[model samples]
Target chain A: MPATLRDVAERAQVSIRTVSNVMRGYTHVSDRTRTRVLAAVEELDYRPNPAARTLRTGRTGMLALIVPEIDVPYFSALARDVIAAAAELDFRVMIDQTGHDHERERELLTGDDREMLFDGVLFSPLVTQAELLEMNPSTRIPLVLLGEHDFDDRFDHVAIDNVRAAHDAVRHLLERGRTRIAAIGAQPQEQYATPQQRTAGYELALREAGIEPNPGHTRSAAHYSRADGYAAATELLRLDPRPDAILCFSDLLAMGAMRAVFDAGLTVPDDVAIVGIDDIEEGHYSRPTLTSVSLDTAFIAEHAVARIAARIEEPDLPPEQIVAPHALHVRESSGG
Target chain B: MPATLRDVAERAQVSIRTVSNVMRGYTHVSDRTRTRVLAAVEELDYRPNPAARTLRTGRTGMLALIVPEIDVPYFSALARDVIAAAAELDFRVMIDQTGHDHERERELLTGDDREMLFDGVLFSPLVTQAELLEMNPSTRIPLVLLGEHDFDDRFDHVAIDNVRAAHDAVRHLLERGRTRIAAIGAQPQEQYATPQQRTAGYELALREAGIEPNPGHTRSAAHYSRADGYAAATELLRLDPRPDAILCFSDLLAMGAMRAVFDAGLTVPDDVAIVGIDDIEEGHYSRPTLTSVSLDTAFIAEHAVARIAARIEEPDLPPEQIVAPHALHVRESSGG
Candidate 1:
């Protein structure tokens, strides 16, 4: 059997509370008492029960991150930042994949497994707005929503201004004298905010430039993967007078779109211009460096983690909505 | 305040023990009793206390994965697989990042913060052989080390045959008539096993091929990001007579190496050939595509989850080692 707190207390000839303080590294504990507990721990090999402490303190010093997929570079990079920040704060992160499954989303939100497993959750929800809002307040844990979900007043959220970010990317393309711009990526409505905002910006940019938006110029896919992007771009290129420029939702999708363009026997920037979002590391090394929207994933992660930790530490505080800015990374793909 | 189990029991017109059975979804509970208890739960929005249940059953019902970084595609993809497998088993995974920190690795073994927080741990140790040998057995509570490490007889482990996989990759390069093969992307000895073993295999292949190994042709990085691969490949290309081929430690690194080759006004397979390990998704999409070693991350994850669950459910069972086979995923980069 593993040595318990009681056993350590008995061995150290001290109260259980004293032993706990010493174990938790309390500064107030006298040197003599700390030494006695340390010696006892070495002698007995005491391992304190986390379950009991969690029950008593209502905190496990842990956080949970729910993402649609860890295999996706964007989400994976975000999670990496969150994990790094959490480690600095001495908090661990528990990961759950919803698989973009609605039932799984609900399960992650209200699952009994999380009641004591984590102190807070950072959710990147793919479910509908109504479904996310359906969580009962009593059962709801401390949560910080990530990614492009619309911010409601009920919960804390950290996101980017997708509209302006997209506008800037398109504006860059237009300024480069590429007018017949086509949007190629996942559908806007499928996701709550980010994609929709980007699409909206594309429309706004076209309208602002006195170029009427063509419904036929828009391309969408089930999700944002290289295969999906390639297929979407191939379909877009099949148009009679295919657009000279394309705006993609992500760098990964952009890579695929470029592949599709090359497959169709067209050169990038010279024959067709492309711009993408989420300036991933691959964008820089790709054949023609990808011109894309670069959001501070590190900043977003830090804000989300800090916000969740703040909410957990001080639940009475008002909910916060954090919006970090994004920048356009000009590379060869955009004729830079 | 949240509704308690006793409160639900009272509402259900049943004993607290009956409510416990219902919460546990115990099979022995009468149908009528289960229905009544469930109705009460719905009426009161009752959520079970996981901590209390964990204390009572001595099972946290949580699994943990300790990886060095989440940004690396291999680890992220591995985490995704583990999460998927654990989800199927109705378990949650707590993630801890060690950043290859030796102190944190030791802490993970001895930290009481982990006790009762997880039923078992999936540790991917980045420590050296001697450091691993020094681990106190008792501190390793239901631990399963993933990736290569000095496996103690008492601990369960899962790993691939790096030496054979690397040899296969290098041999493929050699067979393709590329004798001067440069190997890049090496981590510190205390950091990881895959790189170490792969490097060893590179030397062995040179020896086996009757080709003298050039120490200057081998390069290492502090980390496994594509940036490091790019840097190393740039240096390799600047050699008096650039190597005819490059074998990277990972596909991501190979992608960067290929980029460097292109940047040097060289063509892949035509002027220089390349090979990598961990055939990640990005490897398939790269311009020329990467020829690499592919391991079944999904299979490894499923097996790892089952092994940890078995250790938790049946503590008396002796620990076992699981070695999944790897294959060479032939693609255009290696002149295949």
Candidate 2:
């Protein structure tokens, strides 16, 4: 068993209370007692219990990484990087997923429902703008926001330029000489930054290339999942003057779209070219290698960890906005 | 701001030392002092610092789920389930990836290198039998091992029957009337339970069908990843009168095998039918839905969590071996 306070006290030939006082930095302890206790602690390899340490120092040395879903490839990759970065700073990360539950996010992020103390929180919620505003956190915890959110500079924010990423995906399709390009991943029910920004980028790219944006060309998906992508693409495939190309908001959606095209007895690029953002590894192994705008998840993870660490050290630091770089990967899916 | 002990002391008209004494259950404290402190604590909603709570009740209310790789879809999915199950039991889970480092696993699981206190460990290691035996964990921490590891019943073990799962996969392919079936993901270097049992099952199934298992037909993958799968499949394709069917140890290998077949201009099922284990979600969305033996990850998660909880309650409970059920999913990849 690991050494307890009694073990240290016994080794130091002092009372347990004296050892506790010295460990807690109490002024009542004499220098001789403190030195003896310290030596005994070292000799016994007695690490302070995190619970007592948290009480004495009010720091758990743990960080919370809250996301929409832990199983998502993008979020999982980001979590791995954050964990590595946190380890470098002598901190540990515990990840949790909101699963788009507003109450769960609110309780964990701000409310007292969560009893576990975190040094800082790196939150990536999938709530809409209205719900985001609704959850105006009133806690004094150090906080860093993750993912695409159009929040005013109130906290440290780390994300890629979703609009530009989407624009780049559509532009790649346009450059491939595809006029009728459709988008799948617009959340028309609310102002969610991810889909909203991507939709804006798609329209801007179309207008810049002298093509009028067709409202009917965009299909909204409730979730950026393969099933939703397949469902939306099935509808888009039936449109009059069907889109020759499709720009999906995520690689998962593009995978579903590829399946939809094949299901319709059409080939990718030749029949319906496709592109997506967030260059997940699945794209690399797909039958037709996927075309995607690779958002730097490692960069996002590193920056977010650094920001949270900084905030924990000095909460007065001004919130900074970090936009990770994104690049368009020309692959077989986009006829490149 | 949270209520401090000083606030409670001031409200209860007692010295901070006296308040501390009352909180720590010191025998010398007067009943009146204890009563006043308790009243003040209740009024202020003061949560005893976790450090003090830990000092008194050696519980951190946290569990660690250590896996070989957090990014693998199978592990990630399992992690999600474990986290959910942990949450339901009012315990939080922290995940860490071993990355197949024996020393790291040894240090974290056994040695004093890992300082973080977890109520128990849910370990899913990829270490070989020798390496596992070499690091005889000396720690008294409660541990529940995950995945296939044949050992004397000293630890709780939860996993699907690797041998049976692999047998079902090969049998399904045989039912499709394909002889000369190839196998991928064997680790000939060491006796790892997962691959060894899988290889045994593959051979058993083939032998039962009156076909001698070809030693050259079995390939070992250093990692059950796409690249490894692709490499193994590419070599398997080079054999004279190439195997008509291939049984991969995991879905990722099957995906890679499928890609290799496409790259060689050989169509799936027509030229090379494939099947894998671990019915990860990617299988559902892959070009030809992959045939796999679905391990009930949720069942495994719930059982592991429950077992750990039981062990935590009664450390002397006899170790229980949990075998989660598995089912063969016959999909397009197997010519279904």
Candidate 3:
């Protein structure tokens, strides 16, 4: 059998309570007793049970990271960074995927299913802020939102400036002498979501260039996936006066759009210069390579972890909003 | 404060033990008492703290899934399936990425960091069976192995027949009127690893076809990554009598190899045909869609979860090995 607290106490010739105090890192114990208890712990390999510790302190040293989908490249990459960052804070992360469903997000926030296992949550919700607000009042757990939608300072948030990033991508295409630019992956009706913010930037850039934003140029996919992007791009290619360039909300969409262009017997840049956000690794090795707006996931992850840790420690602290930096990577797809 | 067990008991006019028994789904209580306690639990919103319950019952309803890296397409897709399967069993999953390092795998197996938090572990180790056996004696926790390696019945395992799958891939290439096929992603020294098994299958198919496997036709990547595959394929292309076809260990590698072929001004399935294992989603959208050996991840995940759940329930049960199904998906990359 593995060594227990009693064994450590017996080995140290001290009370079990004293051993527990030392193990918990409480400074009340004298330095000599602490040293002896540490030695005994090392000798017996008596690891403290996290469940018992959680019962006493109400801290599980664990966090739940809720994403829309794990198979999605962006979310998978983000999860990798979050897990690494959480490890630095000595916390384990439990991943939960909601499939971008509003009801599932609500369950994660309000249901008792996972509440007892995690001390805090880092959520990237697909639902609107209003929907989140409906559940916010009942959320007893500490949560930090990651991504575009914010709950009006109701929770801490970390994300790239999607609007600005999109504006830059469109502006890059404009500077390249490509005027008839189409925007793909637009979710115009979903306020404050990724598509809305990015499409707004696309329009903002077009207006600045004195080009009227044609409703026909903005195409929305059924969802943010390569398959959806392929379908959307295929539809766009069938339109009269084909777009000279395409700006996508995500790298996956751009990739799919590029495939559609190829399938249509057209060359990228020569037929449709394409750019996308979230420069996932697959983009680097794509046939023509991909030009993308790269969000610094490491920076976002560090800030999110620090913010969630702070929120957990001080539950009443005022919410802080952080916007991570993004860079436009001009590559072959964008005719760079 | 959230409602507690005592509050539910008081509201229902029952003993706290009775409330606990009902919450635990113990059937000794009368149906009428069970109904009353459940109603009170619902009315008071009483959530039994999992930590407190774990302290008494030693079950966390949680599992640890340790993979080499979550960012990799295969692992990420596998993780998604695993999480879904575990959720159906009323368990949450904690993800741990070892970065495919032996030391990290050892730490995950023997380190106390997560030992106290999970009821069972589903580990896909990067280390060899010998290295794993070194740590097996110290692992008191229930463990199920995932992927190519087996621990000599020390634990349960679920995987596809890597050898048969690879043999079929090579045989498919040969039947396509393409000889002089080169294999990528060989890890010869790492016995029983996916690369080793797959390479063996490639050789087996070649031998069955009355062809001697040329040592020069086999190439090894430093790792199973797109970049490594690109580098390896680039080197292979420079050989005198360059390979007519290439087989890669993973879809990512094949994608990268395809990019290298394109960069060399070669047309896929014309200058060279390529096939990869692991039918990740990106393969569908590639310029020439990828042909691959598609492992049934859903089937593997279901079996792995069920096996782990059984192991957790009966730790001393004999180890069981299961081989899930796989299929060869012939697409444009292989001229199908």
Candidate 4:
């Protein structure tokens, strides 16, 4: 059973009016009281009826887009497309970056930001507790989940097949007669979904080809950034038997690995070859054009916007999971 | 002499209470009525007292950072740094992109958005008229103008020295003894300040070096994008006495120019050298690394956030115009 506002106020040790004011995005409430009420909302899993709320207070025609990092090329490109898509629906978007903060993610997902000023939320979270997302669920706040989250079908989700994307990258290297391949971007310590899925695909491809994956060849990156990629590849190149080719989880990491290859006085496709995902624009202009699996961010943005807008109008709509397409382009780096 | 709420109400033919409610961000106001009231506010040049508004209704701890395009590396980097800087001051930032639209720029600069929710705005508009910003001066909304704009001492402005930055880029090419140095990114049609200032600096560098600036050597680009750069360079390479070197206004342009040079069966520096501004991270990892002028975005972001926060405290403080530093980074593209 969902908790009522009175129960939330009791759990927060505040009056019902105080809890209501906090939820309404009023600035009169102190930050401490707001925090307490949000915590209770998270703990008790309180959900306000979307239809009732819409009838009581008119919709703002504003949607909030929350991502982990705005500077990352993938997220920035996705954001531009999402803004354009929402604009077509007569909705304006407000963008915010959590900078991969877990607590901040909790605050925005379950706190006043849910329905305060925005009609719905299009979120690409890195460290979200999926349960907190169900504090209101799919019918609660007109939310759409984006990127790699293990979807439980309680909310609308938009994603790419990360595992298959990784498998295709590794399989392409094998087809090129490159046997000793390595992988970059395995984050085993975190609960992140993208890296784990990519790792599984990489190993699965190698096993199917009758090659036992060497534990030493797989590297973990704390972040899918060029610096991290460079550091990981630098270590990989120093191994007794170096990797002949590498499959990076992201293009930024591939760029770093490419630099590492050049700095070590090796020529691409001769001494080393590389492939990355999310075919960012930088890859096309890089010295040797990068071979990457292009995730259709435009499709993801369009559908995510469409789904959120639909959910706002019909809160009883069943949750959806839309998988965007991905394709690999052969470039100089992979000896295409 | 500023217009009052009553004047705006009279112009829109709406009640004073309705205008007042719109100013307070009430959602009960219909979209059509909201649009009419906002248009009247823009026409009448209504100025609301930000200090009084904060007193009447508690201040929202929100700041807005507006830019031309978030997908552009320069702006995205700036947004990331601005968000970090604002967080340090216990403030949260919401970002929006204009996509270089003139109408949207006018709306955000002088509309109900001014004091509806955000405590202040950090705007980097592409096509803003210098006057609508005066609808309510810097004090009226604690605004900090960023990037290339002609400042008239009516706002707190943070900018890079574009002319000097351009001059440094061109001078580097000349120092390499490349006399036939054609340039790209001259916009003769628009009132945009960056390209115009860059053109001035490029001509000044050639004159100082005792060379006649040939009319054929100047190429205008519709936008500082890779596609535009590639097309412009393709044309420059077809000249009778083709340019032995190129000066691109931006790093993305240089990347495209480099590709054009390669596609024309030539090599960088040994054939046609190139220099670009905005030392983006992509430049560092490109095949033959690009030479560029690095704008200090961190300094701009830090100073802009500090200025806005200070103005929110003392709204009557004197406006400031800060010029962030720039430096030339010589890399492989310029025969470094």
Best-fitting candidate, scored by lDDT = 3
Candidate 4 or 1, higher DockQ: 1
lDDT of 4 by residue, B55-116 (tens): 23446566888888889899889988898898789676767778877777777765532344
**Across residues B127-207, which tens digit of lDDT does each residue of candidate 3 receive?**
777777776443347778888744577657898889999999999999998888899998746654788888889999999
Model 4's CAPRI class is incorrect
What C-alpha lDDT, on a 0 to 100 scale, does residue A220 get in candidate 1?
Answer: 81
Interface RMSD, candidates in the order listed: 6.6, 7.9, 7.3, 12.4
* Candidate 2 residue-wise lDDT at B266: 90
Pairs clashing within candidate 2:
A51-B51, A52-B51
DockQ of the candidate models in sequence? 0.39, 0.31, 0.34, 0.17
Cα displacement (angstroms), candidate 2, residue B52, comes to 3.3
Evaluate model 3: give its TM-score.
0.87
Q: What is the docking quality class of candidate 1?
A: acceptable
Q: lDDT of candidate 3 vs native?
A: 0.85
List residue ranges in candidate 2 displaced over 4 A: A1-48, A113-116, A128-138, B1-48, B111-116, B128-138
Docking class of 2: acceptable
lDDT tens digits by residue: candidate 3, A28-125:
57999999999998888665778757655667889999998998999889989999999999988999899867788888887653575787898898
Cα lDDT for residue B28, candidate 3: 60
Return the TM-scores of chain A for each candidate in numbered order: 0.86, 0.85, 0.86, 0.81
Second chain only: TM-score per model?
0.84, 0.86, 0.86, 0.80
Question: After superposition, which runs of candidate 3 have C-alpha atoms over 4 Å from their true positions?
Answer: A1-48, A188-192, B1-3, B6-48, B188-192
